[model samples]
Target chain A: MNRLYHYPLSPFSRKVRLSLAEKRIEVELVEERFWEQDADFLRRNPAGKVPVLKMGNRLMAESSAICEYLEETHPTPSLLPSDADGRYEVRRLVAWFDDKFNSEVTNKLMGERVFRKIMGTGYPDSANVKAGSKAIKYHLDYMHWLLDQRRWLAGNELSLADFAAAAHLSCLDYVSDVDWNRSVIVKDWYAKIKSRPAFRSILADQISGFPQPSHYSDLDF
Target chain B: MNRLYHYPLSPFSRKVRLSLAEKRIEVELVEERFWEQDADFLRRNPAGKVPVLKMGNRLMAESSAICEYLEETHPTPSLLPSDADGRYEVRRLVAWFDDKFNSEVTNKLMGERVFRKIMGTGYPDSANVKAGSKAIKYHLDYMHWLLDQRRWLAGNELSLADFAAAAHLSCLDYVSDVDWNRSVIVKDWYAKIKSRPAFRSILADQISGFPQPSHYSDLDF
Candidate 1:
């Protein structure tokens, strides 16, 4: 059987999980503390990161690459648009969340508040938390602008862009870092995506030491 | 006419530039000081990053997205493999260079040595430079291992993966951060890639404050 080695709160791992679920591809999920940099894990993925998918003899590392590979191999219920222009928009938004949003909001808030404690790094840095808090509002507003313009993050059809964004936002939400009241449109978008069957496993995710936030799994929330 | 707003020392920009050139797409290059975050540049890319491409009416941001779009639109002299597994390896290595290598090596060394002075951030942090310098040896070794197995970084065929790795290495090479002497196989790979006609503009690049290294433009080197 195919297996996925992932961390509960890792947005990149979560992105791949959403893709796998949306495609209805069954895979055994194994929790991995990637930061510890175990030799076995390093052998599986030299990058020493989470969300390594083992399909048959193939082991894949990068989340975006894995997602695109999935799309190429299993084209059913396509997570990308048909046209090149549409695909470009989807990929652009995916990078925005995975790269920019990740560095600005997720890394600061989650990195300090959750991972530091979990990894035994140290106490949370309040300055990074403050900056992350301020940065998220702008991101929410930007999401509101996009959601206002289209039904989904990239376009009318729900795509990997939505998954990419929801992955990060959901992780932040797990730590109660996201403000649902910031933008109604953005909140509505999250609620819509959060209710999907694909999101069930994510909602059920439990990270030890930090109990899941009450609203994190709430569909109505 | 197509136009690209880019920065000379930006690896992301160079990746896109290499793709455009390889695909034989004619584009006017416009140097954008994205760090300044000009209202106009931010309007082009809200992520406030370099390497924004304008092709006719469509404005594109994100290097990987733009490169993929270019591959799809211009299939002649393709930059990606024809098969799914081949494509997966290429994308994986592309991410390996663009994300992992950028964070571990490029951002630390180039960000400290060149960008700090150019952006007026502060003096170079010796700690980061030391870390980057140390980290690059392992990266070069990794490249040697990969090159020993396959003719190119990803496979026998040339792909965007080569461009992505070269883009970062070239940027670091600008500041003479790369120790080309560390790995002969990796050096051979660079020499082969550097000799490509598509690399002409990059080899000709001359940063105002930092003179191009004597060996930078020399194909024989």
Candidate 2:
């Protein structure tokens, strides 16, 4: 059986989880306190990162690559489109969320509010948090702009792009960082994605110290 | 002909250049002043990011996605292995450099030392730069540990993983941020990649204000 070592609030881990569920690949979920730098976890990924997958004979890390590997290995319910251009769009959106969005929003807000405390880094800087809060509106606007033109962030079909975006936003939503009111289209898009059977586990994720917002598990919110 | 809008010191752009060169794809290189954010460049990628590729009729953005798209569309000399497990290993290492290395080293060091001056953000933060320098040693050690067992980063064959790791290290090396002597294996691996025909343009890269190191252009160091 495949085993996933991940943190509930990590967008990258959530992405892999969503992809596994999407492909109907059964895997054991092992919550890893990556910050602790456990010896066993380090053996799995010398990099000491979360979302490391232990498949039959292979261990893999990195969410995007893991998702692609799963997609290629398990062809049912594809998360990526067939065409090269379509695949490019999905990959671009995934990078946008994983790199850009994570850098701008998730790292700023989550890293500030929660991760800092968890890591014993320091108190959250309100300025950085404020900047993240403001920047999220702009990102939501961009999402709304994309959703306006297509059914999904990349195109008419739901791809890993949607899962990547949802993963980050869901984590932020858990900390009450997302303002769904910023864009109605984005909200509707989230509602649709959240309603997926694959997302049930993600919605049920609970961190010991951090309490979920009232609307985090609510599909209609 | 394909055109790449890039900055010499940008690791993301460098990764794309390395991939293109490895695939034997000739591209007209256009040095983009991402700091200036030209209107024309913005049209190419509204995010106004570097390493945007204008290939044939398709305009692509994001280094990771562009690299994957290139691998799919131009499969002649494959940068990614054919097998599912091999591909996973390659992609995982790619993400290690692009995301983890970028965050821990590039953003903290380069963003402070070089990018801040270019973007007029402020003077370089010595503390952040020091932290990045310290963090890079650990990352280099990790790379050495990975290379100790395998011929290349992912495995025996030279893959996208090598390019991804080299791309970031090259950028840091440009500003004299990397201590190459820390790991002989890592240094040898980089030297092997640096000697590649595709790395010629990257080695020849010149930024006006930031001068290159003595070994920057040397095939052998």
Candidate 3:
């Protein structure tokens, strides 16, 4: 069995978990205190980050890499398309969520509001929070624009791109930071993805100190 | 000829350029002012980012995606390995460089020292620069550790991961921000990669008003 070192609210970890679940790969979930930088965890990932996967003899770090590994080894219920161009689209969208979206929305909003408090960095800066709030609208609008053009963020078929976007949004939703009403397309897309059987574990994730928003676990939400 | 819309100093663009060079794919380079958000460029990528690839009738955005696409379509001198596990390792390292490295080091250092001056976001924050400078040492140490174990970043073979790391470092090196003496292994590894013919264009890159380091183009440096 594979073991995953992760944090409940981390979108990167959530993205890996979602990919594992989608591929029907079983993994033992081990909550890691990444901020603390535990020795054992450090051994698993010298970088001292979450979403590290211990699979067989290989200990892998980085969500994108772990997800792609799972997709390649499992090959069932494929998360990436077979074609090169199609695969490129999926990887691009995944990068978009992990890099751009995380920077513009998740890190700014969630990092300021949640992680700052947890890490004892300082109180959340209202100005940064407000900026994050405004920035999210643009991202959500971008998602809507993409969804309007295709059935999924990448194309007409479901791919890892959707999961990547959802993972980030779900984390934001946990803190009640996401305004689902911003875009009907994005809302419907989330509803479709969240209702999946694979999403059950992610939906059930509970962090002791951080209480989830009321709508976090609701299927219809 | 394939056309790449990019900025010479953009790490993401540099990653794609390195990958194309490694794969021996010839592309016409078009430097894009992403900050300008030109209408034509925006039409190419709704997000208004580079490096975007225009290949025949198909236009693609995002560095990871473009690299993957190139790897698939041009399988000669493969950037990724044949096995699933090997490919996973490569992808994982790529993500480490592209996402974590970019966030922890590149964004902090480059955004503070270079981007702020270009965007006129006010004077560079010494605190941020100090933090970035400090953070990079940690990242360099981590890279050195990885290089200690493997011939290349992902494994025995050169892969996209090396290009990703080199791209980020090259951008910093252009501004003389990288402390090459921090790790002998890292320096040797970079020197080996820098000596490649693929790195020639990157070495020659010049950003107006921002001069390159004295050794930026020195193959033997």
DockQ of each: 0.93, 0.85, 0.77
lDDT of 3 by residue, A1-221 (tens): 88888998899899989888888888999988799998888888877888898888889998887888788778889889898988998998898898888988899999998899888899988888888899899999989998999998889888999999999999999889989998999999999899998899988988777886669989877
Kindly state the number of residue pairs that clash in model 2: 0
Chain A only: TM-score per candidate: 0.99, 0.98, 0.97
Compared with the true structure, model 3 gives a TM-score of 0.94
Candidate 1 lDDT, tens digit per residue, B77-118? 898999999999999999999988998999999999988999
Best by TM-score: 1
Q: Assess chain B of each prediction and give its TM-score.
A: 0.99, 0.97, 0.97
lDDT of 2 by residue, A22-111 (tens): 899999999999999999988898878889998998888888888998999898898899999999999999999988888889999999
User: Which regions in candidate 3 have their CA more than 4 angstroms from the true location?
Assistant: none
lDDT of each residue in B1-221, candidate 2, tens digit only? 99998998899999999989888889999989887978988889977899999988888999989999999999878888889888988998888888778888999999999999887888988988888999999999989988999999998899999988999999999998889899999999999999889999888888878988788888777
Please report the candidate that would top DockQ against the real structure.
Answer: 1
After superposing candidate 1 on the true structure, give the runs of residues whose Cα lies further than 4 Å from its correct spot. Answer: none
- TM-score of the A chain in model 3: 0.97
Docking class of 3: medium
Question: Model 2: residues >4 Å from true position, as ranges?
Answer: none
Q: Which residue pairs collide, candidate 1?
A: none
Give lDDT: candidate 2, residue A4. 97
